[model samples]
Target: MDETKIAQLRNQSIPPARHFIDGAQVSASDGGTMPVTSPIDGAELTTLARGTHKDADRAIAAARGAFDDGRWSGLAPAARKKILLAWASLIEAHALELAVLGVRDNGTEIGMAFKAEPLSAAGTIRFYAEACDKIFGEIAPTSPGALGLVHKQPVGVVGAIVPWNFPLMIGAWKLAPALAAGCTMVMKPAETASLSLLRLAELGHEAGLPAGVFNVITGEGPVVGAALAQSHDVDALVFTGSGATGRKLMEAAARSNLKRVYLELGGKSPNIVFADAPDLNEAAKVSAAGIFRNSGQVCIAGSRLLVERSIYDSFLEKFAAQAKAMRVGDPLDPATHAGAINSESQLARNLAFVDAARAAGRRVVTGGTRILEQTGGTYMAPTIVADVTQDDPIVQNEVFGPVATVQPFDTEAEAIALANGTTLGLAAGVWTRDLSRAHRMVARLRAGVVHVNTYGGADITVPMGGMKQSGNGHDKSLHAFEKYLDLKTAWIKL
Candidate 1:
C-alpha cells in the first residue's frame, strides 16, 4: 500500500452528514453532538448528531406521517420495487466507503468488512427489492359468488434497533424488508458504530425514498432506544442486541401499545469437533476462524469448542498453534487476521472472562493478555482454554470476545446435552465427515440454524433466528417479511 493508494482508499471513504431525518441532514435540537471515535487507535473520527428525546419524537412523528400519508405505502408494487432497487444500487456504489467506516468505527478488519458487510447489505437490499413485487394476495375457494381472500398489508411505522457488530449490514437486514413491505421506519443505530447507517440514510434519500419514510436517531440506548421501543406511534419494534436488552424492549413495547416486537439476541454457540473428523488440522483452522473472526464479537460465534475425548489432545495442539499464529493488528491493514476489540468496556469484559476461566481450573493454552504496546486501541489476543467443564462460567456465558473454551465430551449424546445446556439456541456447528452423524446432529440440535461441517456461513436467502432466549422472528429471506406485514382475511359478499 503506497502513499497514493492509501490516499485513494482514504478519499474513497467519506463519512456521511450525521443526522438524517425526513430526507434532510440536520443537527440535534439542542445542538449537541458526540465524537465518533475509531476503535482502531482511539482517534476521534467524526462528530455525529447526538439525538435527544425531542429528536426521537420528531423521528417517530415523521415515521408515523409517512405510514399514514401512504406516499410509500400507497405506491404501486412495481414503483416501490424500482425505488428499492435504486437504493440497492446506491449501496453498491458506496460499498467501499461503508466497509471502511465499519472498520474505523467498530474495529473490524477492513478486508473482511469490505468483502462481507457491503456485499451482505447490498444483497439484503436487492433481496427485498425483488421480494416487493412477489408479495401477493391469494384468493380462496368460496361458496357460490362469495369472495374470500387473504391479503398481506404493511404494519405501518417500524422501529429498528441494530447492534454495532455488522452495523450497516444488519441495519440493511432490518431496513430493507420493512421498506419493501411499504412500512415507514425509525432506525436507532448503536452508539459505538453508527457511521455507515447514517450514510445509508443519505443514500436512501438520493435513491428517491420519500421524506419521513426513513429516519435515524443516534443516542444511547436508555434514552433514544427505549423511546423507540416504547413509542406509541411505532407499530412494530425490531431489535438486535443482548437478551436482557431484548427483554426490556419487549416490555417497553407491551407497556406502550402491545406493538409487535422481533428480537435477535445473544448466543453461546457450540462448535463440536468429533474424533472421526476427516481432517483435524483443517477443523482446528476453521474453528479458530469461527471464534476469532471479528474478535469473537459476533452473536453467532462458535465460542465453545466441544471436542471428543479421544481427539481432545490432538485438537487442542493444532487449535492452540493456529490461535497463536493469528496476526492481531490495525484493522486498516489487509494482512491483519484479527482486529482490536470494539471498546474499552468490551475489552475489560473479555479479560474478566479469561480470568474466570482460569479461576475455574481451565488451562490457558495460548494468547490471553491485552496487547497495549500493539496500539492505543483495545486489543485482546486470541485465547484458547482447555480442561473447561460444562459448568464453567466462561463456557456458559456469552463472553463476546476472541476466546474459546475447549471441553471434551465422552459421547455424541453428551455433546448434544452440553451444547443445548445453555438458554441460547442461536447457532451451532458440527465438524464431521460422516453423513449419518451430521444428519443425526442436525436433527438433535436445539439451535435454529446448524452448520454441518463448517460455521458462520449464512446468506440473505436463508431465514435466520433463534429458537429460545436468543430471541424470535426471522431476519433474512422472504420469511422476514412476516415481521413487517400483517395478514388479513378479507371476505366480500356478492
Candidate 2:
C-alpha cells in the first residue's frame, strides 16, 4: 500500500488484543476473536477477543470470589469512595481517546461525541463516587427496649449489557453505581460498539480496581449476552436496548436464577407543541435538534411531533425547513450536524420506515431520501413527515433514525391523548407558554420525564427511567444506586 493508504488503514485500525479479567489483560480461552468495524464506513477497526461461555463462567467465578472474599464489600465506605474516585480520575485521563473510538464505532458526530460522551461518563462516575459515602443505614424507632435498623448492602456480581448507541455513557451508568456500592461486575458491550467498553476496563485496572471487580466480554447478544443473563453466578443484570431484547433478557434471567433485571428500553416519545407556544421558531429548532441530534438513534428521540391544529401548518413548515438545512456528512467534520446512520443495517431500517410512511399515505415534507454521495458512510437526510394518524406504524414504533412523524390535534386533550398513545413511555416534551398547561401535561403524561418548552434535555442529577413497556429502574442521579444495592432490616429484642 502507498503511504496515504497505509495511514488511512492505521487510522482505522484499533490496537492489539486487550481484555481485562481478574485485573489482567489476557486472550480468550479458546483463542477466538471478533473484528470491530467502523459504522461510518466498512473499515475494520480492531479485533476484540470473542469471549465464550467458559470466559463468562470464569468472569462470574472471579466476581463471586471478590464479593465473597470481602476485599471490596468488606472495605470501609471511605476506602470504597477513594477507589471509585481514583477510577473516575483515570477515566478522565483517557476520555478523549475513548470518545474518538465511540464516534468511529457508532458513527456519532465526533465533535458532539467529544463533548457529550466523556462529560456524560465522567459526570455519572463522579456523581456515584460522591454518593458512596452518603448512602447511610437508617435506625428505625422501636418500642422501649427493642431495637431495629435497616441497612443497604451491595448486590454482588452485576452483569451489565450495554447498547451500541452511547456505549461509553451507558456503560458508565451501570459501572459507576455498581462499583460505588462495592459490587463486582461483568459487562457485555454491543458487538457493534465494544471497543470503548473494553478500553474502559484497561483504565479501570490502571485506577487500581480489584481483580475481577470489573470484567468486559465482547460477543453477540445470543452468545455472550445470553450467557451473562442466564448465569446463576450473576446476581443482577442491567441492560439498555430494544424492548424486545429487554424482554428476552428478563425471561432468561427468570429461567436461570431469578436474578434482578433492570432495563431501559425503546421510546417513541412525543414532542407536543401547542398554539400558545412562546417562541415558535425556538420550539421548532429545539424539536428538530432533539430528533436529529443523534440521527434520531437515541432511545428517547422525540420522534412523534404533535402540534396543535391552530399552529400545525406553520409549525410543520418551519420544522421541515430547519431539518432540510441540516448538514449530513463525515462524522469527524465539526460543521456536520447530522452524521452517518450507525451502520448499513440502520440505514436500511431507516429507509424502510420512510417507505412505510409514504405507503401509509403520510406526507414527506422534506428529506425522504438517503445521501450516498456523502463519502462511504451511511447518511440519511433528516426527514419530516405529516398527516400521520395515531394508529400509524411510524407513530407507534421506535423508528430509531432521523425520521420524525408529525400529527395535528384540535384540543389540549387531543394533544395529550396523542402524546400518551404509545406503548413506550420513556419521555415526552411540551412547548407552550401557559404554565398551567405545561404542569397539567406533565402530570397527565405517562412518561417518566417531561421537558417544558424543550425536548430531550437531561441532567446527571435527575432520576431518568420509564413506566410500562419502556422498562423499569432509573439510570442517573442518586436514586440510581438503589438498583445495585439490597436493603435489609435487622430486628432485635431486648
Candidate 3:
C-alpha cells in the first residue's frame, strides 16, 4: 500500500526539515514549524520552518556577504568545478533516497521520480560543472593602440524559486550553472515540497559547498518568496511557476533592485496528430503519455490534443483506450502511471477544471473523477474530454491535471493556427509522416520548444523556455548559464 511506503520512510532515520542559512540548519525565529505532509497517504513526514520575510532576509544577507567576500565567486573555475562535481556525485549516489522523498512529498509517481528527479538533477549539476572551467572570455582588436577584452562573471546573489512539481530537479537546473558561474544563491523551494531541498542543502554542506554559497528558506509565496524577490541584494531572480505569479515577480524585481528576472511559466500546449503520421498507433500512445505524464502537472504537457478531422474518431478511440488502461494509484507503486496531486488545493483546482469542462457539455470519454480515496492520497484518474472547441475555457486554460481536451482539425495550417492560439508558447508536439508538413509545423509554432512526432521530452543538453506570456529567458543547457553571468568589457591603451 502507498501508506506502507510512507511508514517505511518514517521508519528510516530521515532528518528533520529546517532552514539552512550560512551553512547551519536552524529553526524559524520563533521555532515555528509547518507540517511536511505526504500526499501519498496524508501522513506527516516531518515539520519545517514556516519561513517568513525575516528568514528570506537572513538568507539574502548571507548570500550577499558570500558574493562580496568572493569566497565562492572569486575561486578559480577549476576549484569551483571540483566542489560542484563532488556535490553532483553525492547526489547521484543518493538518487533513490531523493526520489522517494520527492514522491512522498511532491506526489510525483515513485516510478517517474526514481528515473527523473535525482538522476536528472545530478546530470544537470555535472553538465554545468564540466562547463565551469570551460567558460571563456574574448579579446577584441581595438582601434590603433587599444585592446578590448570581454569577460563573463557571475551575477551575484541569485534568488531562485523552484516549483513544487519538480522542486529538486528544477532547483538543480538553477543551482548547477549559478554555482558553476561562482554565484551564490538563496533558494526558495515550494512550500508543498521542501524536504528534498533541505536535504540537498545538507548534502551540499557535506560535499564542502561553502556555507552561504547555497541557502534555503521555505514558506508561503507571499512572504518568503516575495521578500526574496523584492530584496535589493539579490542580483538576479529565476523562477519556474505560474504565468500570473511570474508577472508579479517581474514587477517585484523591478520595484526592488531592478534585478534581472528569468521565468519559465505556464502553458496550454497542443499535440497535433495528422492522418499520415509515421505510426498512428505509436503517435496516439506517445501523445497520451505526454498529457498523462506526471498527471499532467508539467508546464509543457500536451493538454490540447488536435487530431486531423479525417482520422479524428479513430485516433480518439486509440488515445482514450490507452489512457484508460493506465493504472492510477499509489505513488509508490511502480506500475502506477499517475500518482497523487501535490496537495489538497492542487487537487481541488484540478477537479474544478474537469467539472467545468463536463458542465460545458464536452464529452468525458473517460476519467473525470477522483480515485484511490482509500489511500487518502490526492489523485484523479486520467481524464480525456472530446468535442471541445478552441474557444472553450477547458481548451484555452491549463487544467494542470491528468486531463486533456480533444479537437479536430482538417489541415496543417489550421493545426498550426489552433496550436498557437494560446498566450503561452512553452511547448507543443506534432505527429506526421509528411516531412514538409513536419518542418512547416515546427517553423510556424510559436512555442519556445517543439517536438516533431513526439512530445514533452527534453534533456539537460537542450534549452527549455517559452515566449509570449510564458515569460523570458531559458533554463537547462548552456544557454541557462547566460542568465547567471554578466558580461564585462575592459579597455586598455598601450
Alpha-carbon lDDT of model 2: 0.85
Number of the top-ranking candidate, with lDDT as the measure: 3
RMSD of 3: 1.9
Query: What's the ranking of the predictions by TM-score, best on top?
Result: 3, 1, 2
Candidates ranked, most accurate by lDDT first: 3, 1, 2
lDDT of 2 by residue, 1-494 (tens): 13343234337556755557788876778889888767677677778888888888888888899988988888887888887788778777766677777777888886677667766787788888888988999999889798898989999999999988888888888999998998999998888888788888887778777888898887778888899999999999999998888989999999999999999997899999988999999999989999998788888889999998888899899998889878877776667797778888888988898899899888999887888544666888899989988888888889899999999999989888888888999999999899998899999999989999888767788988997799999998888898999999999988
Highest-scoring model, TM-score = 3
User: What do the candidate models score in CA lDDT, each in turn?
Assistant: 0.87, 0.85, 0.88
| Residue 422 of model 1, lDDT score | 92
Error of 1 at 235 (Å): 0.5
Candidate 1 residue spans exceeding 4 A from truth: 1-17, 372-374
Relative to the true structure, candidate 3 reaches a TM of 0.97
Residues 187-225, candidate 3: write the lDDT tens digits. Answer: 999988998888888899899898999999988899888
Task: Give the root-mean-square deviation of each candidate in angstroms.
Answer: 1.7, 2.9, 1.9
Q: Which ten residues in a row have the lowest lDDT in candidate 3?
A: 1-10
Better of 1 and 2 by TM-score: 1
Model 1: lDDT equals 0.87
